[model samples]
Structure formats: structure tokens, C-alpha cells
Target: FPSAEHGLSADTEEQLRMRGCELIQAAGILLRLPQVAMATGQILFQRFYYCKSFVRHCAEMVAMACVHLASKIEEEPRRVRDVLNVFYHLKHSKGKRTQVPMPLDASYISAKAQVIKTERRVLKELGFCVHVKHPHKIIVMYLQVLECEKNTKLVQTAWNYMNDSLRTDVFLRFSAETVACACIYLSARTLQIPLPDQPPWFLLFGASEEDLREICGRILRLYSLPNVSLPSMLKEVDQCHLALDARIAKAKLAGGGLLAVGTPTLDVPSSFSPASKAGETGAHHSPIGNTLCNKNSVHVSFQKKVWKKHCSLLCFIWTPFWVSALRLTSLSVFRRSRSVSSPLRSVSPTHRQKISRRDREREKERERRRERERERGRGRRDEYSRRR
Candidate 1:
């Protein structure tokens, strides 16, 4: 079948192509391509399956293009020419080439143009399934809960660990929800903590319990594997990427929905505030029994007259009449006290002028002393120079 090519099986070449597509999709993430590109690739793989056509090109290039289109749609669009030229160089370079024959003629501009056309086809094939649910978001939520008593660095280490779990075929077998739950489960165990309850966010994907457990086990194995560094695991992922990407892309594009046909839409959590706690009434609690009390009734009503009449004398003293008068009187008293208490203000103008004149004379005397000192220094320097 390696030589045979172009057909279906229990494990078909087409299935392999789809697998290649998923790896490519994952690599696109490392390549810093937009998420839409993965979506685009997914759509393209399904379309390619329906057509059963095999072009003698780098599967990575096509997957990249699919991703590029998705990026464009998602507004994370790469420069079409850049995508083309980079892949073109990669295709022509034998050491880096993904397949037997590479398509160097697939220049950046040409690829861009091709993607533009492919985008429409992809959109049609996917039935315009534009929104994507990423595990990265779920990973963030899991980290927030897991790190409740820890710093961000601990959570970050766990998140970094979980990213490797994503590269495996587990995502294909499980929904993003289940995969996210597994990541959380593994992250908690890695930190040597009790596995946190799957946050409400995981329920958004509606994964079955059995599937989620399987996903969790695979993630745990990833944690236990010796000498399997994240970078190396990622590189291996890169090697088999095109096939993985193809599988994922095929599934996505074949979609009635991402997981199942007409799956109920999951409500996205608005934000993680104290107010977002389960069944809590907003940020502040209502005053005691106020929820049941009548607004217009005397007992619960917040009336000004009730406070004015019954409140402490301190409250009456704080009334506007007393407050304003007291303020004005305080200002008058402050002015009068200032006038009386200030010796400088009470002093006659003539006497004050005399003090100022004496201060000026003293300042002049100091300046004269400084000038005399400078002259003496100069004279001493001149005497020393003559002696030398």
C-alpha cells in the first residue's frame, strides 16, 4: 500500500493522509501559524478525502496552506507570500523535505493565491464551521484552579508538561473537553496534589466519562515516560505531523459539528471573578432579609427623615444648616485667629520694613566677607606662585 497508494482501507492511505494533516496542524502551532490554519487544513483534508486525489507535493505545504487560509479567516492571517516562500525553500531543500518529490514552484504568491481559492472550497466543505474550541483555553482554566494555592510558575510548568500530551493521537480519540480534563488531571498529579474536580469549562465539550479517563491515562503515561523531553517529543511530532494533521483536518471538515452532529452549544464562561462563584448572588450580598422585604415599607425603607429625627445628635449637628454655618464660622475664626496669633501680621509696616532692611544689610555684609575671603585667597596664591 506504500507503493500502491490512492485508496481506502481499515487503515487507508487516505486515513494516513489525514494523520499527516494533524501532525502538520500541530507543527503549524509551533510554526506560530494561526489556529484557523489548522481549521483550514482540517477542512482541506476532508475535501481531499472526498476527491481521493493525491498530488505529488509536500503534505506539510498543503496543510500549511490550509492553516494559512484558516488564519486569514480568523484574522491571524500570515503573509501569503511568506507562507509560500518558507515552504517553497523547505520543499526544495532535500534535508528538510517531507516527501519524495517537493513542490518548489509553489511560491509564496502562488500559494497565497491558491489558499484564497482553497479558502472558499474549505469553507464550503466544512459547512462554514468557523469557531474553534482549543485545549489551550481549557489548559488555562485548569491551571487557574490547580494553582489556587500555588504561584503561576508551578501552573506554567504543568501547562508546559500538558502540551506534550496534545501531540499524541489522543485528541483524535477524544474531544477537546476530555483532553482538557485529562491535562488537568495529569497536571494535578504531577504537582503531587489531589486531582481537582473538572471545572465547569470541561463540561462545555460534553465528553463521556470513559473517554475522559482514557485521555487522562495517556497524559499520565506521558508524564511517566523517561528521557522524553518536551522538545524531543515535539520534534517527533513534527516528523509525523503531516499525517496527524490530515486526520484531524479530515474529522473537522467532515463535521456536522466538531464532536457530533448538532451538538448542543456550550456556554462559554464569561470571566473568573469572585462573583462567578456557583449560585452566589453577584459580588455583594444583599442587606439581611432585604430580598424578602418591601421597598416602600417603613422597616426596610431607606428614608432620610427617619435618620434625621431618630439619629444621634451628632447627625443633627452634621445637618446642612449647622454644617454650612460651622464651616463659614470655622473659616472666620481661622482668619481671626490667624490675624491675632501671627506676630508677623501684627507688626507695624515701618518696623517690618526696618527688619527687612537690617536683613538685607546682613546679607550684604556676608557677601562682602565672602568677596574679601576670595581676594585673600587670590593674594595667597599669587604669593605662593612668586615663591615657587
Candidate 2:
């Protein structure tokens, strides 16, 4: 998975994947979505994690979004509200078997928005190729070809195995046809029903014995493992994420020279990396959360290419329309936001001089008025002395 490529451990990533798949399966049952939808949802969850990291996304939220997207892809759509309600109870039922569902409040609204946004992210990552070819029907077809369709026990066993295998990464690694053949092989072995060893039946179906054994081994491992608790898995993922964030924050602090080389100041952007700005050296980079493809690529501030790319993006971000609409009233505020860089310069020099002159005149008038008041006080004091 892409997460493993980053920093997530193998065991943690595997658990999170399995837990997400289990959540999808359970939510599908509660929402009355088809098995194909559940399987598709699980596959999508795997594919997404392959692109994103576990530290970057909440596994539970992504799982819910995958199920939501999968339902729509399968044309068995469930509304966001229904999906939310089902998951709310499913998550809340940790202590109580009959946990009450959460009401449609601000929290639900926020969660609803997250699910929608996450769905977009999933679709974006998958490039809209949401088509999932399930091996459930393939297993049936291959069994029929083998004339074992009459054996309900064998058929059901293989079918269950196919579903269980979805919780693993076998779908992403192996083809649907191979998975189907492998399921048949395992089912026959479990029932002690001998198939043709002369030619090794799976080979006829394009699945080698090595592939079948690998898939079967993965499926069997799932049985040996304990059931993953969704809430606990989420907690573990959150902890890992928090640790990662802290590490990244530390790296950023270390790299940016904040409190490392000097005290932090307002001109952090310009002075953040003085060495790079002076063309002395490349800016230090944090290795914690860099780009997925390239981790060691620190932003070279002295490089014109990097600055130009960022400037281009900023140019699109803050057009005149946005800058005019912003509540940047003070000159200091304008100076602070690069979006409205040097608004002070926009005023003509003559206009600035006129404003400075007007301020000087106001100060002189105040001084003259104060002198007159002092004179009147002296006159009163002199008259009192004369009377005395």
C-alpha cells in the first residue's frame, strides 16, 4: 500500500485495511446494499489507501465514504443521511448492543460534509474508474463448468471464501479469474472432494498452483486473525496520525530554523530560510510528510522554478476580485497578506503626502488651541493676584 511506502508499519496498515473492509461489509448489510456493492466498496478502500496514507486520512471516515461511493457505482445508491445514521449506530454500539442513533445535528451535518468531500477525493484518486469485477458470479460460473454446482455446501463454502478474501489485498494483487479458481481449490480441499490431480484443475482456468496456494494462504491467515474492532482501530490510527503530525511539526520547526537558529519573527516567510534566500544553500526540508512520489525533495527557495510555480498558483488564488473583497483594512494587514502585496504602494505619492500634510496641520492647530487656553489661565491668575 502507498501508506506502507510512506511511514506506516506493515502490521498497522494491514489491520487498518482489514478493519475498513469489515466496516464496509457490516454497513452494507445494515444499509441493505448488495454483496457486490460491499465488495466494490472494500476494493475501493484498498485502492484509495494505496494512493493516500493512513496518517493523512481517517480510516473510518474513508471507509464510510467508500461504501457510499460504491453504492452509487453499483446503482444501489443510499442517501448520505441513511449511510450516516447506520454508521453512527454501528460505531456507537461499542458498549451497548442496541445503541441509540445520533440525531441530525451540527455534528451530523459536519460528518455529512466530510463524507461528501471524502467521496470526491476517492473518485478523484480512482480517476473515476470505479468499475469492480466481482468474483462471486465467476466462482459460480466456474463451479458450473466443473459440474459441482449441485453441491450446495461446496458452492456456499467457496462463496464465503470469496467474500472473506476481499478483506485481504488479494484483489489488488491477483486477477478475478485467478481468485475464483483459487476459491474453488480451497473449497474442494476443505470438503475433501478430490478434483483432477492429473492436470491440476486450476491450471485449466489460468490459475497456477503457486498462485492458488498464495491466495489460499492469505485467506486462511484472515481466519487465524482476531476480529478487528472498528473503534479501536480508529483510535490507533488517530494516535499514529497525531504522532506523525507531531514529528512533522518538529521536522518543520527544525528545518525552518524556527527557535533553532533564531527567535521567530513576523517576517518568517522572507527570513524563514535565510541561507536559501541568500543563495547560500538549499532550504532544509522535513522528511515526515513530503510528496508521495518524492520524499527527499525539499523546497528550494532560491530556485526560480519553485517560486514561479507557487507564484502562478497564488496569482490564480487572489485575483483583484478576491483581494477587493477581503477584509484587509489596515496597511499592516495588507502587508501581512501576500495576496494583497504592498497595497500601500497602490496609493499615489502625492496622496500620501497630502495625508501627511493634513495630519501636520491638525497637530499645529491643537498646539495653538492649547497655548490660548494657557494664556486665559494666566490672565485669571493675574486678576486674582491684583484683587488680593
Candidate 3:
């Protein structure tokens, strides 16, 4: 009966993902699997949660299965039992002192069963698309292509960035090429390595500067470096979600005419008017009586004045951006529809007439210019013939 509302909070979910990434790395190290396997497993674990909630599934079991599945997919298979044993050792040895030791009774069977079950679930959630494209190969290819492979420090830093990026959701959101470009960009910036400016590097991968900038921002935000606080960012994200929910609720209420006649009585302050007190004290107090009272009238007028002033200020602040956004969106939609449909159907008759008139005038002007040029060329030919 667990719902999303009762599930993990934003901060907790991020922490759990970080833990899962750590486990994937540890398991990879313990099994002697290549870094690619670890990266693939981390991506699988992250992608699985997009389809299934973390509240319903255990993170540890899923992480182990991901690593196990990744090894098989990478053609470096590890036994399910061996993977579980590695997890068991990691938990018991590194777990906090206050943490209760995992029960030995039926633990092996349960752990192994959970790993297999979760592995199947992960595969199903991923739609059997086990092939994860990691940025490591792309990083190497980019370094070689850019002729920067000789800079061991830069290459190693970029490799570390790619590894760190897997801990975040960038792998799920962006392409391997983009992530590779972003990592390399960040690494170069960190090392003060000057890259070519005329034709930026990201363009080679068909990625724009903005795309690389966004990916790098996400990666930097994930690292929560000295200037960036993860908790504060999470708080801001939660606030934005809450604001969006509030806007939706307000729109629903407005559309339903539930708040059309009057403002909420509960929201009006009782101290502002005696009528509000009458409504509270007298059982037979009429709803209209509150609005009829002179004191109440004055209070309502003042509230309305203040509300209008605030609305005007807000409109002044946001009008330009809102107008521009709407204009751009409408223009794009109109262009798309015009391309798909007949020109006659897309534009009104009046506008079409205006456009046709402009086109005709342009055509006439072009014809006149072409005639003038031809006449001048003939006169020049005649003069040259005379001179000859």
C-alpha cells in the first residue's frame, strides 16, 4: 500500500542512489571486472528506478543484480552466489557499529533469491535493452581525435569525471557522446588546458555549446563542490515542485467556479471586521450580512486594492518574458502546421491576400532590376564593338 507520497523523499532517494553506486564500484573491484562493467551496472541500477519506485525495491539487492547482470552483458560473467557473498562481506565488515548484524538463518538463500529476482525485474524494466553505452570509450576516442591523449593528467582527470558522473542520472538523461564531451570540457577547464575556440570541441559530436554546458552543470551539481550545497539545491527543487502543485490546484479551483463568488471565509482575518466575528459567534449570521456591513466593506475594499497592486507589479515583472515565450511557441506551431497543410488552409484569406500582394510587388521590382542590368550589358557590348 506504499504510494509515491509515502516513498523516499528527494534527499533520501539521492543518498540511496549514491550508496548503490558505491556498492556497484565495490562489487566490480571485488570481482576483478573492468570499469566498463561497473559503469554499465550503475546505469542499469539508475534506469531501473525510473520504471520502479525505490520504496518497493531494496537498493542493495538491485545493485548486486545490476553488477552481476552487467558482468554477463560485458562477457565477464560472475556467479550469483559469489556476488551475494561479496555484498554480505561488505555489509558486515563496513556497516556501522550500531547496525544490527544481518541474521545468518536463511540469509544466504534469501539474498541469492532476491538477487536473481531483482535481476529479472531489472531486465524487464529495462525492456531487455542490456546494452548500455558508457562514456569511457567515447572519452578515449575524443582524446585520440583531439590529439590530447599524450596529456596523461588530462585524460586521467576526464576518466575520473566520467566515473563520478555515473553516480548521477546524467547517463540516463544524456547521450554517451555528450557526457564524454562534458567530462572532457570540465577536465580541461579544471586543468586550465586551453581548447580551440573557433570550432569548439562539442560541435564535433553534433552537440551544441548549450548542451555541453547543461551536462557539465548537472555533473558539477552532483559533485556539490565547495561553492555548491546539495541540500540547498534539493530544497529549491522541492520548492519548485510545491509551487507547481499549488498553481495546478489554483487553476482547477478557478475553472470549477468554486472560488468565483467570494474569497475563502477562512482566509479573512476576524480582527479586520466585526462582521467576521458575528459569523463566528452567531449561528444565524447570514453569509451576505458579512459583505453588507460597512466595516467589512472597507476591509474587502482595502484587500482588493492591495491584491490588485500586487497583481499589477507581478504582471509588469513577467509580462515581457511571457509574451516572448508565447510568441515563439505560436510562431513555431504555425510554421509547422503551414509546412504540413495547404497554404490556403493554414492562413486566413485576408492575410494570404496581403502576403500575395507583397510577393507580387517583389517580383515586379526584381524583373525591373533584371531588365535594367540586361540593357546596361547590351550598351557596354555596343561600345566595346565600336572601340574594336
The residue-by-residue lDDT of candidate 1 on 1-388, one tens digit each, is 2212322232333334544455556646655865545644564554443433332233454465566666666667676655555554444554554544434564545766766676565566557765545576776766565454355655675566445554345655566667776666556566776543456434544656677678777655544534422233334435444554565566555542342222333444345455356226622356543534344356535576667667767676679788889999998877666556755553456566777999999999999999999999999999999999
**Clashes in each model (backbone N, CA, C under 3 Å)?**
22, 0, 0
Model 1: lowest-lDDT 10 consecutive positions: 1-10
RMSD of 2: 24.3
Instruction: Residues 291-373, candidate 3: write the lDDT tens digits.
Output: 46657679999999999999999999999999999999999888767655646553566567777999999999999999999
TM-score: which candidate is best? Answer: 2
- For every candidate, C-alpha RMSD to the true structure in Å: 21.7, 24.3, 21.3
Top-lDDT candidate index: 2
Expressed as tens digits, the lDDT of each residue in 257-324 for candidate 2 is: 44321335333454457545534333235433235214334345346687898999989987876777
**Candidate 2's C-alpha lDDT?**
0.83
TM-score for all predictions? 0.40, 0.66, 0.55
**Cα lDDT computed for each candidate against the true fold:** 0.55, 0.83, 0.78
Off by over 4 Å in 1: 1-58, 93-114, 146-154, 161-175, 196-209, 217-388
